[model samples]
Every structure is written in structure tokens, then in C-alpha cells.
Target: MTKCLGLVAVLAALGFATQASANQDVQTLASDPANWAIQSGDYSGHRYSKLDQINASNVGDLRVAWTFSTGVLRGHEGGPLVIGDVMYLVTPFPNVVMALDLAHEQKILWKYQPKQDPFAAAVMCCDTVDRGVQYAEGKILVHTADTSLIALDAKTGMEIWKVKEDDPKNGASGTGAPLVVKDKVIVGVSGGEFGVRCYITAYDLNSGHRVWRAYSMGPDADMLIDPDKTTSLGKPVGKDSSLKTWNGDQWKIGGGPVWGYMAFDPALNLVYYGSGNPSTWNPVQRAGPGGKRIDQKWSQTIFARDADTGIAKWVYQMTPFDEWDYDGVNEPILTDLDIDGVKRKALTHFDRNGFGYTLDRVTGELLVAEKFEPDVNWATKVVTDKSDPQYGRPLINKKFSPFETGTDDVTKGICPSSMGAKNQQPAAYSPLTSLFYVPVTRLCMDMEAFKVSYQVGQPYVGATLTMFPAPGENGNTGAFIAWDGAKGKTVWSKPERFAVWSGALTTAGGIVFYGTLEGYLKAVDQKTGKELFKFKTPSGIVGNPMTYMHDGKQYVAVLSGVGGWAGIGLAAGLTDPEDGSGAVGGFASLSSYTGLGGTLTVFALP
Candidate 1:
């Protein structure tokens, strides 16, 4: 008995029960296609895996290996983390964490469930959707809907540390995943509609102590902007960049939430993320000059900050004086591309504003920008000239500018609904083909601007929108397209009956995988855009797909659920009219296809 006890202690000390060591050289394993260690698969946010065992030739033989019901009836938007013999899965709302032993008939290792406030659900703008959790240094990190950042022992599922990052009572909730960059666990909040002053906070991975805090809208100090040092368009942000942009104390209620995934550059030591739109979609109430004011300095912009210290490196506003709710919260993918015979380090982003931008990652230089879809009439192009460096201004169609249109009531037939062309769903980059596969919506809306006053923690939006399919698109509402970011061109596109609401996954097997609002997990040939395989999932899929190898076999997994802004009206059973709050009448078609559900499905070549 004494010898057995001593052996057990030694095993615990060695972290044998955990099965996977987060201490493993992360940089090495992260790049490995056989292992999925990070949320976006790797720091680059490419969402591309190098595994070819499940290549295009044999993809048609794929079959379901297993499926697990999360038992949480909400949208699931992120994939699982498979490390060695164990897999970690996180569900919505209650934020339950489950560990599965993959080696033995999917044995349940342990589960960690948190007791959460039910009120948080009511405050969430959309159905509670948790992007995912992170694992590092023998701990699993998760951001809860009730505004808590928690760390759990990977082996025992015991709580290691928990910290309150946001207050749900004040209309702030957390749905974005926490990113672990070395010793820092970075998190952000979601409340653009709730009027909560949002910020991104980083905590020490070991102690859970706050290291730095950066607000999305505030003075230079609170925003961590250095007047002479922080810059955008190769120019300094100047004194009080964020403060000068707003009227009075409006910046306090300004809505610039960080509710999406972030990408990191280890070599540059910088992390990049985009902020949400300004408060009250009606820009008339927010005041400020229309175009080229630089006052909307930080909101609706892409920020580059020092990963270690949270100091601003540079920024680029995708939408200036955001009249449309075009939040720049999509994932910014990093890659190297050859443009005009020169290899350039490129950061490609697909904005909700219907434009695909490719910029120099290191210097924040705008290289190429183009409308990704033909229905994008709001902005003709992005203007980055030296004299008028309105990142996305000068090109915003004057006819669609809600502020310029003199009509007090409704500006009819605006292409690309307030939801923009894409939401939080991530695109994929395939190094093998040098193309990006994007899932985008072809939705347009008729919007009416109104007057509203801000009240703390209450919905401050001042707009009524009615959405519908873009005209002249053959009644199709979405498409999956292959883009050449280096040249700002679309290679090929395949239309879908509904919005393509899934994060894209590309593989060395020459296949691109994604999910649909109608419950189909599909794989298309990476080079030819031909449908190779698809499986009907249990529910609509708004989640990302990931690939990993266990026991020498490649496996693909994805979260299947339906509850984003696109389907919120249906999932929540709201009685909105044909032209009401969320345009539930516009999205009524989704009800015929799939309802709310939460399931994790895995597939492998049989």
C-alpha cells in the first residue's frame, strides 16, 4: 500500500493523468497538422491543417466516427481541442467542460460544470454562443457568458482560478474565446448593443492576476494608445484619438466590443483583433463629423498591440463614421503572398462591410482592397491615398450613407444588410492552393434611422431594419467563394440556398470544409470547387471545423448548433414582424430547415 501511494504521487507530479502537457514546445506542435492545440488551429488564424491522410481522393469514403450531445440548446461556434489521447469540449451558457478519452471507445474522463446566473441569458444580444476554450500549461482556460475567466486543471477538471472579467448585470457578457499567448490569457467582452464600455483584458496565466486592460473606446491612457507612438495609416493616432472622436461623455457608452477571435505573430510579438461598431447603430446620435474626421478613431478598426504589454502598435479603421453596423470583428488571417513578383507578409481580412482587405502585416500598409461580392454597393472601394487616407471612406456610396440621405425615416434597399456580408464565421487559407475559401451572406436590408438616448446597461440601438435577399442573385442568399487575396480577385464561387454560416477549414488533402445554416457539413475540392462529400448534421452549423490525427488516423470534428444573430429571432422564439427588430420575418426561411440544438460530430475515413 505504501509503494502504490508513492507511485501515484509521482505520476501526479509528472502530470501523467493529464495525458497532454501544455508545456510541450507549443510553437512546434502548433504547426503540426496532426495536432490541434490552438483555437484557430494556429496563431496565424489560417484555419488550415497540413494533414493529407484524408485527402480528396479518398474523402468520399469518410464516415461518422462518433457524435456527442452537449445537451445545451444554443449555438456552438467553436471547435474542440484534441491533445494526445484526450479531447476537451466546451458548451454554451453553463459553460460545461468535458474531457473524453479517445483511445477507449470514447470514455468520459471528467467534466467541469459551472453554476451560472440565469439572468445573463436575458442580457445577451444573441443566443449565448461560446466560441471555445483554450489549454495551456496543464490548465484549460474558458470565458463564461456571465463574464468570468476560469482556469481548470486539465487532468482532474478541478478549478484552478477564476476571475470576474465583466458584469452581466451591467449588460456585459463574454462569448469570445480566451487566447493564451505565452504567459498571458487575453479575453474580451460582448455588449455593443447593451451599451457596455467594452475592453480587452489580459491576465497572468499562472496566477490569474490582471496584467493590463485596454478599452475599445476611451482616452489614450485607458485605451493604451501612445499619442506620439500609436499610429494608423503610418501616422500617429495623435492626442486623445478615441476621446476626440466622440461627443461629451459619449465615449463611455460607445460600443466597440471585441467579440471575435484574435491572431498573433510570434516573430513580431504582436496580437491583432478588430473591434465592433460604435454605440447605437444610428450614427446621428453619436455625432462627430461624417467622413475623414478620424474621431471614430478606434471603433470599427483593426488594432495591432504588443502581446506582452498591451501597447498599441498600429491601427486601421475599416469603416469610418460607421453608419452601417459593419463591425470589424472577423478573423484576420496572416500569410505570405507573392504580389507583382515580390514576396510580402500579408494580413488578409474579410470585413462585415463586404470588402476583402490585404495589408502588410508588419507595417500595417494597405496593399490590396476589393469588394468580395458583386452585391456590395455601399462602398465602391477602399480609399488609402496619402492625402485622404480614409481607410474605407471616399468610397462609401453616398446614396447609401444613412446620414447623407436627407430622409428622416427610412433609407430603402441598402445592399448588404446591417449584418454586413459576413458575421463572426471565420474563413480559411490554403497554402497548397494560395487561395482563401470564404463563406459569405448576400443579405440586404432597408434601414430607418431614429433618435435614442443612452441608458446604462440597456439596449441603445436606434435603428429599425428589414432584411431580405440581395436583388439579382437568383434568389440564393449566400455563397462560398475562393479568393486570391494577393490580387484582390475571386477565383470561383458556389451559391447556397441559405447563408453559409460556418468557419472554413482547408486541408493538404486538397479539400475545403464548412457547414451550412441548413445542417450540412460539406467538403469541396480545394482546387476545383467541386462538391466531394457532405453529411447531414443534427442542427444548423455556425461553428468552426478542426482536424486532428489520433492513432495514425485523421479525424475531422465540428460543433453543430444554430443560434447566432442570423437565427436568433427563430431560436429565441421572438414575435418580430416581417420588418421588426432582428428581421425575423426575413430569416423565417431558416425555421423550415433546422431548429436550435447542440451536438459535436466527428468523422474519419472508413
Candidate 2:
């Protein structure tokens, strides 16, 4: 008995030692910028992977390692979180969380499905898929479909706690991925299209306690005040001046949903998020009487807020009084670049308004603003001096204008469809190659406006956007372009049959990875944009691709299934469906592929 007791203690001690060593290794990997520690890969939000095990030279030998289907049929846009040998993913609708053992033939260690309210689906502007999950402080945090944030034991998939972000009766939900920095879990609210006041909030990871809340539209006095008591962006206005830009206190309920993934610079301590358009598709409703103040304070703007205090550092409004539903809620990628002659840290965005912008990360100054889209009639040019558009504002009563015409039809032929050339799907930058790889569409939209009315829960504004082929462009196809970030010039371009809906992933091996809407996952030459390798999946692929090494073997993974704005539009014939929509086609086809289902496909060297 004594011998047995001693042996048991020895085994226990060995287990402890192994756990400690494993934890230390994880800490080392997590802290390294080369391992993609943040959402966009090391706070720069570049979405570029540094490891280069699978280079363009050897990409042809890449084969599927394994595939895990979530069995949930909605749109799958969530990117996978690869930490060590375990990969974490979030699914749509029920918002189930799954942890897979990548080293063990993609074995599912555990799956977590948080209880969600069914009615929440009604408020989602897009599909119900959660963008991704955050890993911090030994916990995995995810936002559910019903506006609830749940923290789970990363290894066990057990729920630690849950926090509700909205009152179900008021109609608000969350679909974007939460950003975890230090001990705070930062998340933005969705449901702005449904007329809810949108805001971003931070919660304590340890206790699930609310730290601070910053509303997208609110009284100046109520905006997030710097707890440090610093006079940052000046004092908040009391009454009339605060509401001057907006008519009739509409600012109180104006919609500016921060629904897309946001990036952060820990060094600068600034959190950057692009705000959506104001409530009511009609600008006439929000902008009453006179134009008053030209640019709305923060709506449709790229906001730089103090990461710790939630105070506005600086804001650059992308569009003034956005009426075309071209919300600026795209990925704000952070990266360091050499602009012209000087080296500077920058935040770049491929805005939905048909322009790409590079701004000084610290001060929010526009450095370069150029049009990347083929056809953009709404805006003649983006004024870099003022960080505003020179010719995009719609006049209230002008003839032939989108607003006064009240023609909500596609034949009118507007350039750069609402989806923009690039949408929420993030692009990736390869420091090794010094080029930015993005999936761009060459489609146009004909938009007609409608008069809007302010209502609590109803869609006030109306706009019908019809997708058309670009002028002189062939089909509604997409192209993968490698852009010189510093020079703002196209390095290379490759035409694709369908839009590249997923985000790009560039590795150290000079390879750029992306998935197409038609379910083909391919690797392209990072420098030349040459298609080096390709593989087909069951359904269309829209989720971002992630690369990680497991058990000394590097693997690339992406979620497959189609159902976002672009996916829905293509499926429903809103745009020209590359798959040739069945004879009687319309928007009804948007929900047609629900049976297509969601899947997680992983690849590795044969």
C-alpha cells in the first residue's frame, strides 16, 4: 500500500510538470506576433500569417488533412482561431462553439451550444453566423446569436459565464467577433438596420462584469468619458450643438452598427472600428430642414478610440449623411508602411463606398485615398485634405438624383454595387512580399432612393440596388489583386469566375491563400498573383482562411457554406449568379441554399 501511494504521487507530479511546460510553450506562441496573436495578425490587423511551411513552390503538393462539417446550414463566415493544436470555430443560428484537435485527425474535443432566443434571427441584417471567437486569459469568448456573450473553458468547452448585451424586448443582437485585449472583452452591438441604438462595450473577462459602454449615437455628455480625466477630444456639448447635425434628436436612435470585425494597435492603445450608416436608408429623414452641420459627427466614420478609456481619439468621416446604405462597416486593417518617403504606422480600409483609404494610425489623418473599384459614379473623388468625399453627397430635391427620383430599381445603372468591390471579408498583407492581397468584384449597382420615415422598429428608408456588369467588364466575376500598399498600385491581378468572398491569408512561403464563392480554395503566388494550387469543397466558401502548425505539420483551414449579402445576392439573382439561377429566379433564392450547410475544411502536406 505504501509503495502504491508513492507511485501515485510520482505520476501526479509528472502530470503537473507536463502541464506547466505545455502552458509555457503556449504562452510563448501566443505572445509572439508571428503567430497571429490578434484578429488581424498582431494588432496591425493585416490578416497575414508569418509561418511559411507551405510555399508557392510546394503548394501543389498540399492536400486535405481533414474536414469537419458543423451540420448547421446557414452562411458560414466565421474564421477559425488556431491556437496550438486546437482550432476553435463558431457556427451560425444556434451559435455552437467547437474545439477540434488538429493533431488527432481533426477530432472534436468538445462542442458548446449556448441557449439563444429564436426571435433574434429576425433582427439580423445578414445571416446568423458569428464571425469568430477570441482566446484570452485561458478562456474562449464568443458572442451568441441572441446578443449574449459566453465565456467557455478553452480546453473543455464548458461555459464559465454569460452576459446579455441587449434587452430582448428592445430588439438588439450581436454577430461580430469579440476582441480580447488584456483583461477586457470588447464587442460591438448589431441590429442597427432594425432601428436599435448601436454601441460597443467592454466586459471584464474574470467576472463577466461590464466595464464601459460607448454608444454609436448619444448625447455628448453621455459619450464615453475618459476615466483618466484627460481633455482628449474636447468637452461634450450640452444640448442644441450636440443635436445640430441631426434633426429632431434623431441622433438618439440613429443607427451606426459596428457589426464588422475591428482591429487594434496595442502599442498606440487605439481601437479602430468603422461605423455603419445612420438609421433609415433615407438620408432625408435623418437630415431634416437644412444640411446644418455637413459631416455627421461619427456616423459612417473610422473612429479611433482609446483602447482603455473608450474615448474618441480622432474620427475621419468616410461619407457625410450616408444615404446609399453603403455603411463604412468594413475591416479596418492596421499595418506599418513606408508612405512616400517616410515610415509610418497606418490603418487602411477598402471602404464600401468604392475607395481605399490609408490613414495615420495615431492621429487619424488621411494619407492616401484612391479608388480601387472599376465603376463608382456616386463619388467623383475622396478629398484627402478633409477626409471627406468631394462629390458623393445626394442633394435633397435635385432632379435625377437618387433621392428625388424615388426609383429603387437596378436598370438605372449605378457603379460599384452596395457590396462594394470589397466588403466585410478582410484582406491580408504579406510583409515578406510587401503586397496586399484582396478579393475584388467588378460589379455595378443601379440604386433608386425612397423617402424615409422614423419609426422605432421599422425600416424607415428604402433603396433598391440592382447589380449589373461593370462598364466594359465581362461577367460579374471577381479578381484577386496584389496591391503595393506603399505605392497604392496594383502589382498583379488574376481573374476569378466568382468573387473571392473569404479573407486572404498570406504565409511566409510567399503564398496567398483564399477561397472563392464557388467553393474552391486556392493558393496564389504572393508576388505575382499566379494560381499555384486549388481544391474544391462541398459548398461555396466565404469564411476567412487561417493557417497554423500542429505536431510539426503546417495546415490551412477555412469554413465553407454561402449566405452573406454577397452570397444571398448571388443566390437570389440580385446579382448575376455565376451558377445560372434556375429559370424563375429572384431574391427568394437567397434562402434556397440553406440545405447547403456549413463545413470546416483543413489541409496539410500529403
RMSD after CA superposition, every candidate: 6.9, 8.5
lDDT of each: 0.85, 0.70
Give the candidate number with the greatest lDDT. Answer: 1
Cα lDDT tens digits, model 2, 237-338, are 233333566776777677788878887665566778988877766554565666433345457777787866787676667767775667888888877789
Error of 2 at 124 (Å): 0.8
Which regions of candidate 2 deviate over 4 angstroms? Answer: 1-28, 31-37, 225-242, 291-294, 386-401, 404-411, 452-455, 569-595
Candidate 2 lDDT at 269 equals 64
What is model 2's C-alpha RMSD? 8.5
Worst 10 residues of 2 by lDDT: 578-587
lDDT of 1 by residue, 481-500 (tens): 99999999999999998888
Clashing pairs in 1: 245-295
lDDT (Cα, 0-100) at 458 in candidate 1: 80
Name model 1 segments beyond 4 Å from true: 1-25, 289-294, 387-394, 406-408, 578-580
